[model samples]
Target chain A: MNHNLPVLVLAFPLLAAFAVNLLGKISKKHVAPWTLASLILSAGTSLWVLKDVLQNGKFSYTVGGWMAPYGIELVLDPLSALMLVMVSWVALIATFSALPSIKKEMPGREHLFFSLYLILICGMMGLVITGDAFNLYVLLEITSITTYGLIAMGKGRAPLSSFNYIIMGTIGACFYLLGVGYLYLLTGTLNMADIASRLPALYESPTVATAFCFLIVGVWIKMAFFPLHGWLPNAYTYAPKGASVLVAPLMTKVSVFLMIRIMFSIYSPEYDFLMHLGIKNLVVWAATIAIVGASLIALTQKDFLKMLSYIVVAEVGYMVGGVWLANQEGLTGAIFHILNDSLMTLCFFLVASAIAYRTGSSRIADFRGLFQKMPLTMLALSVGALSVVGVPPTCGFFSKWYLLLGGVEAGQWEFVAALIFSSIVNAVLFYRVFEVAFSHSEEEPSLKFENSRILETSPMMIPPLVVIPVVLLVIGLSAGPLVREVIRLAVPAL
Target chain B: MDAWLFEIIGKFNYWIYVVLMMTGFYAMIRKNNLIKKLLGMNIFQTAIILLYISMGSKVGGKIPILDKEQALAGAVQVADVVNPLPHVLMLTAIVVSVSVTGVALAVALRIYKEYGSIDEDQILERIGKS
Candidate 1:
């Protein structure tokens, strides 16, 4: 049972997805509990797997008793084990906040939403653990298709945005497939470890070069890095609040994880940094542009959720840029940021969804006097906002600090400047929202404290909201140990 | 020049796939109608499928099967059989493509119902007005 923990982590949610759909035929009430139980089981197993990997070094599990280099393999190094734990636990927390939103937004479709939701979680779990290049593409599509379905369930303009995402996402997936095909043609193996072993000799070949470009670009498009990010903001913004809360935090961050996997696992740092020096600088520059541009745009948004979407765009820039800095600190910051950014994004989106759930509005103007109306939710938003702005004692600040240190070491002053500028812009953006929420307006007397009792959101939403801020600080205070123990082990030799 | 021509002709399958993929990509980006974009996406995915299938084929190679007696006697030769992995992989790809098409069509149908048109320009106008 201990040996099979990796497969069990994926199996729980996948089986629960089917169970939820079937049981919903009789009653919709079973969907939430079933989904929660499966995610908890999956997350629990993932944590156990992480503990095992940490206690003992890395290990691999072959699917069904078939051997590697032929059958599918699930590799559980510290890196992937950490990612598995992150994706599962984040999905679990997001689901807690999502249930009530789903209940309120689309009442009768609870089972359908959670069914797709659980499958998406399963797909992400599979994605982080699978050792086959082609299997990653399949799991990517599974996550993507379910996301498209979940987003299209929104009331208006959502189907259109989801359709656009399908176009971009399919192109990205196909490009990745084409790259894997090229690798297979050269190495005659589908396993990532086997391909990596064979890649050294073929590094100088033009075919190898083309495959590398295709793979990186494919992943970039999926993660919404810079110019390829056109599909993200709209798809996320227009999605149902429940779906957005889950998808917004996890999707791009998981794709960033894939990029890191490709860079370190399949192709070594020597190949990525030394051989392709020009391309490395080019990517960092692109990340700089992404950061500055997205932050500037984020400052101009009037809608709260739309603003957060652009900030997501900038956070992708941070991770991508950090990786391209091509040093130990940069890579560590990037991997650590994957964990921190996902939690921070989840925190922000949860608060946004909670606000939208009770008020039926996400406009900044509607947030006026929200502090008086819902003090706890506003406090969560404040903590999330400070984290996003890179305030000290929060998880976001430490990752940004590593990123900045990495940028300075690499002498990429532009990237460093861009990171600082984005942080300031984030500070301004959140401050504006806070100012609006705190100010008293005489025109809207209905929102005044005297008119109505101050009420928080539903009981369902409060737990995750409270849990995330504490987790952020806990992760923040322990950043030193986390980086030294897990992340340092995860980073491949430079 | 002749060597270049021979090289191009030798991998004519890949060239054709590149052409198909680009055509589909263009339609996906450049076309106005949502259905046309979906059609382009199909063409793009099909080209990839064909590329993978072509990769699996070998000259004069038989289906990837082993004779029972030959396997027992340890006389099977790898060169005699074509690769089966790519085909199996592409089978999954085809299933994914079909699922994607189904989802895209469903989303397009919803778009048509909501805004009363699937044209990109018209949908934009409607969204703007709304």
Candidate 2:
């Protein structure tokens, strides 16, 4: 049972996805409990796997008892194990808010939505755990296809945005497949470790370089890294509240994790960082522009959800830039930021959904006097805002600090400047929203609830919004130990 | 010049696939109609599938199945057998592409229902007016 835990972490949600759909045919009410129970089980199993990994160092499980290099394998190193925990737990927490939001916003599509939701979670979990390059491509498609379905389920312009995403996402996944094909042609192996072991001798070949470029570019498009980010803002902004809360936090973060795996695991640091110093510099500079540019664009958005989506783009820049800084600290910050950013983004999206549920608008102007109407929700937003701005005592501050240290150490002053610039822009953006929400407006009345007895937000929604901010503070305070124990182990030796 | 010509002709398969890929990529980017874009995506994926299939093929290679008598006699050379892994991988890729195309068409249908037009410009113009 202990040996099977890693696969079990994935199996629960994959099985639950089909089960939920079938059960939904009988009654819609079974969907939420079924999805949540499976996610909880998956998260618990992931934590157990993380504990087992930390103790035993690293291990790989070959599917069907076949040996590595030939059969599909699921690897559980500190990094992947940590990512499993993060992805599962975040999926679980996001579902708490997602349930009520789906019920309210989607209305009667709960079964279908939750079914795709579980499958998306399963895909992300499989992505982090799988050791085969070809397997990763399949899981990427699974995630992308489910996300497209979820996004298109939204009313109005959503299907259009999802269609655009489908085009870009397919291109990205195909590029990755093409890259893997090139690698297989050269190395004759689809297993990641096998490919890596065989890659050093062929590092100087242009085919190898081209393959690396394709893989990185593919992941960048998937993660919405700057120039390839055109599909993100609109697709995420127009998605139904339930879907956005889950996809916004997990999708890009998992892709960044994939990039890290490719960089340090598949291709050695000597080849990625040392041999390609020129390309490294170019990517870092692009990340710098992505950070500053996305933040500036985010500042220009009047719709609050659109602004948050752009912030997600800039946050991607932070992780990408940090990783490209090519130091231990930078990698640590990048991995740690994956955890912190996902939590904070979940917090913000949950709060946005709750507010939208009440007020029926996401425009900044419509948020006037919301603080009085929804105090707890507003407080959660404040916590999330401070975290995004990298204020101290939230998890965001620690990761940004590590990223800054890495930038300074690497002598990338422009990237460092961009980081600081984006944080300030975030501060201004959140402040403007807060100022509107807090200020008393004589012309506009406070938002009225349909039922006087009910709370500001749904009971289902309130728990995650409240829990996430607390988790942020807890993670912030324990950053030192987390870095020393887990994240440090997760970072590849540079 | 003779060697360069030989190189181009010898690897002409790759060149053809790259051309096909570029054409699909062009349509995916430049086409106005959503259905055309979807077709472009299919073309792009099919080109990749063909590229992978080409990689598994050899000029004089047999299908991966082995003759038991030849295998027992130890007369089968590894090079004589065409690689089967790429073919199998492409099968999975084909399924994924089909699913992606199916989802794309469904979304395209939804887009038409919502905006009453499938052309990018018309949809955007409608969105702006609304």
Best by lDDT: 2
Q: For all candidates, state DockQ relative to the true structure.
A: 0.93, 0.93
Clashing residue pairs, candidate 2? none
lDDT, candidate 1, A1-494, per-residue tens: 27889999999999999999999868988998899999999999999999999999899999999999889999999999999999999999999889999998898889899899999999999999999999999999999999999999988778988999999999999899999989998999989999999999888788887888789889999999979999888888889998999999999999999998888888887674334778889889999999999999898899898999999999999999999898888888998999999999999899998888777888897888788778888888888888888998999999999999999999999999999999899999988999988986566744423323325887899999899999998998999999999999987678
Residue A413, candidate 2: C-alpha displacement in angstroms: 0.4
Give the CA lDDT, 0 to 100, for residue A466 in model 2: 82
The runs of at least 3 residues in candidate 2 whose Cα sits more than 4 Å from the true structure, single-residue gaps closed, are A272-274, A446-453, B1-4
Model 1 ranges off by over 4 Å: A272-275, A445-454
Q: What's the residue-level lDDT of A25 in candidate 1?
A: 69
